[model samples]
Target: MTVNTRELSTIESTILAYFQALNDADIESILDLYSEDPVMLPFLQPAVVGANAVRANYESTFQLIRFEVQTTIQELVEMSPEWAYVRTDTSGIFTPIRTGEGAPAAFHELFLLRKMGNEHWQIARYSFSPAGALPPI
Candidate 1:
């Protein structure tokens, strides 16, 4: 399949929008990036599937902490006519809402995006984990 430049640009914009929503604490905007039956695999957590489950996960997270994220797109590939894969390195700081504690955070994320119709892209699957090599004991 031919990869249109405009389509590729749209995908990159969508990825940035995801991080913007997270940093803004806009759960609704974040959820809008995902498909109806999207799946999210958070680090060391059970796989969260479907919209409601995904909503709950973000809700709990937003309640606990606020995030400021910076993302660098490492790779973007068109997997099929309707699917694209994106890998990104993200670094940020999160402040606990309750304890008023702040800490730096970093992660590598993989997102599988599905082109909904012609121009719109939504994340169908996502996974993320801490960014770094395992520490030696």
Candidate 2:
């Protein structure tokens, strides 16, 4: 069956917008998609807390590399209308502007989302790691 864009939930739309913002490197728009107390756990990096830190993280990141990535929402579980979590897998090329080289990039991400005061969904906690092999289960 065909999916109707108009019928998409706020969380779904927000996640889509988030990926677009990432590709665009629109820091302002990226920050707009986060909650007041935002948290990010980037790959091989310490936890980044607060809006300012997140901003810095993205700033430094964009300076080093640019992502031409496509993100797929693997699963979306709604705990309620106010809270949810989205699992996603992103894969594409990550190009380091300094070297002008692009490499295969893949990651698995999780977003802990909540409805803000404006009744808009925003990410409160987000974490991602390399998508390849990990410790055996």
Best by TM-score: 1
| TM-score of each predicted structure versus truth | 0.91, 0.87
Local distance difference test, candidate 2: 0.85
**Candidate 2 stretches greater than 4 Å from native:** 1-8, 133-137
Clashing pairs in 1: none
Instruction: Estimate candidate 1's alpha-carbon lDDT, on a 0 to 1 scale.
Output: 0.88
lDDT of 1 by residue, 1-137 (tens): 77788778989999999999999999999999998889999988999999999999999988887888799999998877789999999987767787666677788999999987664889999999977532211
lDDT of 2 by residue, 6-112 (tens): 32467888899998999998999999999999999988889999999999999998998787889999987777656789999998877887887778888899999
For candidate 2, give the lDDT of residue 55.
98
Clashing pairs in 2: none
